[model samples]
Target: MSTLLIKNARNIVTMDGERNVYPGGSLYAEGQRIVAIGYDLPYDKADAVIDAGGKIVYPGMINTHHHLYQNLTRNIPFAQQCGLFDWLLTLYEVWRQLRPEDVYVSAAVGIGELLKSGCTTTSDHFYCFPNGVSGELIDEEIRAAQELGIRFYPTRGSMSLGRSGGGLPPDEVCQDERTILTDTRRVIERYHDADRFSMLRIGVAPCSPFSVTTDLLRESAALARSYGVRMHTHLAETEDEERFCIGRFGLRPLDYMEKHGWIGDDVWFAHGIWFDDGEIARLGHHRCGIAHCPTSNMKLSSGTMPLAKMLKAGVRVGLGVDGSASNDDSNMLLETKIAHLVHRLTDGPTAPGAEDFLKIATVGSARVLGWEDAIGSLEPGKAADLFIIDASKLEFAGALFDDAALPVLTGLSQTVDTTIVGGRIVVMDGALVGVDERKLAESAQAAADRLLGEATFRTKIDYRARRNALSM
Candidate 1:
């Protein structure tokens, strides 16, 4: 078996059951499992060794929600100032032009950015499927994640409610229920791995409340449960969504979902910001998980989630970068920083600290994805997924006092020195191990340009002119 060792870290924030911090620590791994973690681990030789002296080591952050395909739609000028509904309306036209190549390149770009920012495991919610394009878009995403060597949980997201049915997306991008479920089963049988230290898993996600019918929601959950896989979707993200649910279903988002048999520990929702106190309590009671996207919420003008209330209610909460279209980038460390600051601003001194958000990013996220037993902490028997940050850097000079909070408080724009997933080094010296970043960026730009051009020509909409008009 191959062996790897990380020696002499300035401090190792283990995020273990006791939240241990080992000063001047070392960790050893045999294959994908951590063999030992403590001060001065024994045995000298290994296939590879990372001298982590002067670096702070932490379990790699887990991103619980993302639309990796949205990387291609980032920074669209017309959608920048719009709130959630208007933003979706503006971007749907562009997203409908997505080709299989767009999905591959965008997933690569987004996952590569997450790795640089120290995220090892990421869950992507890719739901947009244009009618004429290849149905193997999720396959393309899996290919990209595999090439990048990051652990992936890709949900086969679908949308079956169209504008004619009072949903947001156009009919051209929506699929029939049979088609959605058929592909969901195919992906699960082909990709969902329940074993420990699995590199890829599949989940079922039927877009969001406003874009999917109630029948699709119920069927998707049933299919996921039958295969013993997890379920994910966007829910209670905005006031607009709340209104849509209330107007259509005669119930709040949570109540509507609960009626559909979606309230359970095996299900997690992205951007859960619009729930009431009772709804929060019900979610906690059901042990349902929530993926908090602080930056994306702020960018879309979605109100602050009752984070303190949810934690107090014993809800399972985790951090996610959300989609690149709304977040405009995939950087987990940056997301942690924003989560810390936003909570402090909204929740006052009683807010959870930076270290708390770090745990939420690692342990809480692992729990949300139902992989807690395998990959959240730096302990013996857990997967060897972690990252190293050079605490000796100039930006971190005065912040080493709190090693656990160092990344969340001061890692602004700080890429990690090394990122390892499944005992393999996917990033070293703040760069992807085997990928040419320049070429990837150029390809993404060209693909995005092509998509936008085709979309504009088909719709006869001048996005630039719209942006100019709005600004004036």
Candidate 2:
């Protein structure tokens, strides 16, 4: 029965179907639903009021893919310059040292960063489950997301095939197929709410094509569908992965996955950077989704995703920050900037514009996660999840001419003035509510130090030396 009102002075980027922008706008919310949004409102009545004078409000960015736990393992010197395969090999050695607390703390820190970047909803793909830690890793991530008050779509990611089984991850990090399935079901029953505005939802992800077996993929997708949940996985990310799929499965990545019940609207793949023209058509036909990670793709030299072609081909596309280790940061606004600039460089005039990038992070990403009706844009009866950027800031001075284009063209890499999720203020006045920022940072650093020291895998491989040796 509580009401909150955002009074006006600036612009409101509605991002609705009509692409409306209201000047000197105001919005009112009752509990979790947006009751009204227009140029003016009864500014005198509300339980709480935020004077959004000289600000530009837009739908909060939704992150469709992330490895929140990887926040604890970023900036690793040994793995800094490596590509996908070598990078995973080096990091698996360190990720095996993960404890339950590491998942909790890392997810908290990662979520903190995403909120500051104007992200209100996110799906974390946490597949690394070392021995004795598999039981409660998803629980920890859900707990962190709940505490932070952001809409969470955490995929119950699993890897059932290890190096012993000719997969990429080490033995300790992979789980039995039965265990992964059972845990996925348990989490769905426990945390996955099917209500329209529910905050937490679960998905089934069996890591990547190279890190899991064919049987695991089929079973995970089936389990997810049986529970009325969604399916997620990494597919066709790099050339190396494409080769792996071809050699082992004797088909392209998309073909192999499609045969295993993964080619449908309810399923989405992360780092979808290596599909052919025919495969893109298939994706469009099946209505599958792609979580495009522009920053991670460039960082790993994974090749361009042909985003404009995919969009034109009628395939659903969304934006994700990928893993913290690959992206090195979880900022949706920053991701939007990179996605906008890189696509223009690769796709030319038909590339996505600044407003298009904003839609990708909001409307398109919500479509990928199947939460479009509830979360995406600013409309009546939709969840009140959005962020306000103070247009008066120095960086946004001259860029206010186009409010929709400004966020993507002139990105804000810092914390926003306000971020609201489901009619709740998770962040206000550039600080997180109900969390001790400094203390949590110190805890994350201490935990990272411990994890680095406790890693049994030696960081003995000198990447720079290896490169020099290769040249010789």
Candidate 3:
């Protein structure tokens, strides 16, 4: 029954059906849904009125993929310059020391950073657990998101195949297939909310092709369908993965997934960078989505994804910040900015505009996350989830040109000032509202120190033994 109104916004980019851009716009929300969207509103009767005189408003950015717990292990110096497989190998040892409290604290820090950068809805791919850590790791993260007031989707992610059974991770970091399946069922029973405007939803993810066995993937998909949840995993990320699948399974990554019943509308993959035309067509046929991580791909020297080609082929393309250890940050605005530039380079310049990138960050990502029906656009009948950017911030000053600002949110001027989730203002005037961020940071650093101090964590796993002459 709480009523809020936003009036006199300098600009409003509504990525609704018409894709309207209203200058000096006004909007109102009642309960958790948007009730009105137009210009010059009567704000006198609202319980609260946000006077957005010098700000721009848009649908809140959606993060399609992330490993919020990986914030603790970012920039571990030994892992910085490695390729895809090497990078995971180097970090798995360090990640084995993570605790429940570590997961909680790191999720707080990662989600807080994302909120500051305008991401209001974020999906986490937390697949690593070790040393008797309980499935309550996900519960702890959900509590953290509630404290920060961000819409969260925490997937029950697992890895069932260890090095002893032909997987990438060592035996210590892998879980028994039965235990993983049972815990996934328990979590879904406890937390999978299916209602609109739900603050939390659950997904089922079984790490990736290399870390999980084929039976696990097939079973996970079947279980996800039974529970009506989404499926996510890493696929065709690098040339190494392509070669590994072909050498072991005698099939390309996409074909292997097809054989295992892993391709469909309910599934999405991270980094579809190495997909051939046939594989791309397979994605379109199954209506699968892709979470494009431009910065992580570039940093790891994985080839650029064919985003322009995917869009042309009607593939569902969205943006992801990927894992913190890979991209080292959860800044969604920067991720979209980099994606914009990278797409232009892939198309040989004179390509898409900033507005196109904004769409990917907002609606495109929501579509991938299966939240477009509730939270992706600034339109009546949708959840009133959006963020405001202060045009006066230093990075954005002198960036808004002319009386009519373009539909695009440019890389130079996307500085977030306030973020509202489901009609609740979680951040205002560049400061978080509820939690003491300084306190959260201190706790997170302490947890990171403890994880990094473990004897096994201190040793980096070298994949030199697996490196063949043709690996390069």
Candidate 4:
């Protein structure tokens, strides 16, 4: 078994039960699990050691929701100012032309950015599958995550209700219910690992209420439960979604989901911005999880999530960057910073502080994925997942007084120095350890050019011109 040690950190902010902070701390790990964390750990000999002097270490942040494939289409000019529905309408045309290579490159780009920004574990919600495209697209995503060595939870997301069926995506991009469930089962059997400190886990997710039928939701939940995997989907993200649910099912989003057997601890819904008091209470009671995407919400002009109320109601809340197309970036620390600022503006004194949001991003996110027992915090027997930031940097020079809040408050505009996942260093000195970033960016740009070029040719819409018009 390989051993790793991180010693002499300026502060180790372990997001443990007691929220321990060790000054000049050291941590030792055997294989994937942490063996000890505190001052001056004994028996320091190891295959690898990170001397974290002048740096602050914290439990690795977890992103509960994302669409990594959307990295190819970020900041599209026409789609920039649109709300969720119109935004989907605009991007679906481009996304429908996605190839397998596109998925792989985009996942690499997104995962690399997340790693550089101090996220060790992330869950991606990839739902778009064009009609003519063959091969397992989610498999490509898994390969990318493996190459980069980031802990990944990839949901087998499907969209069955097409525009013909009053859904948002075109009919070509949607699949039949049978195919969706069969693939969901196949991925779970093939890729899911429920063992402690697992590198990959699979989830069952039907895109959303408007994009899927009731039958698909119920069956997907059943399939996931059968395999003992978690389920995820987008819900209550916008007023349009709330209206869609009420118009179609005569119930709010939560009630509709609950009626379909989706109300449980194992199920997590993304962008839960539109739920009411009753829905929040029910969510807390049933222990449903919410992946709050503050940047996406603000970018789309979606209302701020009632974060303080949800926390007071005991709901499970975690931070996510959502999709790169919407949020336009995959930096989890930036997401954490935005989560802190937005809630403070809306929830005022009742809003949780920067430290609380850090906990939410770590422990709360692990709970959302039902992996709390293994990967959330830094403690003996838990997964060795954490990141180190140099507090001596100029941005953080005077902010060393509050080590816990440094990442959210002052560590803005900078990536962490080192990011370790499961006793492995995937990012060091603000760069990916395993991947060539320049070549990856070139390939990503090529893929994006092909997709947008083909989409414009087919649809006769000048997507680039529209974006260019913005600058002019």
- Top-lDDT candidate index: 1
Candidate 2, run of 10 with poorest lDDT: 463-472
- Candidate 4 lDDT over 1-472, as tens digits, reads 9999889989999999999999998999999999999876785799998888998999999999999999999967767767778778888999999999999999999999999999999999988989989749999999999999999999999999998988878998999999888888888889989888789999999999999988999999888888888889998989988898999999998889999999988889998889999899999998989999999999988888888888888888888999999898999999998899988888788788989999999999998888899977899999999999988788887667899988988866759999999999999899899678999999999999998899989988767755432221
In the range 251-296, model 2's lDDT, one tens digit per residue, is 8898899899998999899988889898999899888999999999
lDDT of model 3 at residue 62? 92
TM-scores of all predicted structures: 0.98, 0.96, 0.94, 0.98
Q: How displaced is residue 152 in candidate 2, in Å?
A: 0.1
Candidate 1 on 214-300: residue-level lDDT in tens? 899889888888889999998899988888888998988988988998899999999889899999999999899999999999999
TM-score of 2: 0.96
lDDT of each candidate versus the true structure = 0.91, 0.88, 0.83, 0.90
**Per-structure clash totals for the candidates:** 0, 0, 1, 0
Clash-forming residue pairs, model 2: none
Model 4 gets an lDDT of 0.90
User: Stretches of candidate 2 above 4 Å error?
Assistant: 456-472
Query: Candidate 3 residues 1-472, lDDT tens each?
Result: 9988998898888888778878888999998899888865555578878998988888998999899999998876666768988778777877888788888899999999888888899999878977576756778888889899999988988888888988888888788888889989988888889898999999999988888988898899999999999999988899988988998899999899889888888888999999988778878877888999999999899989988778777778888998888898888888887887787777866666777787888888888888889988899899988888876566655668832133234545444688988889888877788879889889988887677677243564332234333232
Q: Model 4 segments beyond 4 Å from truth?
A: 467-472
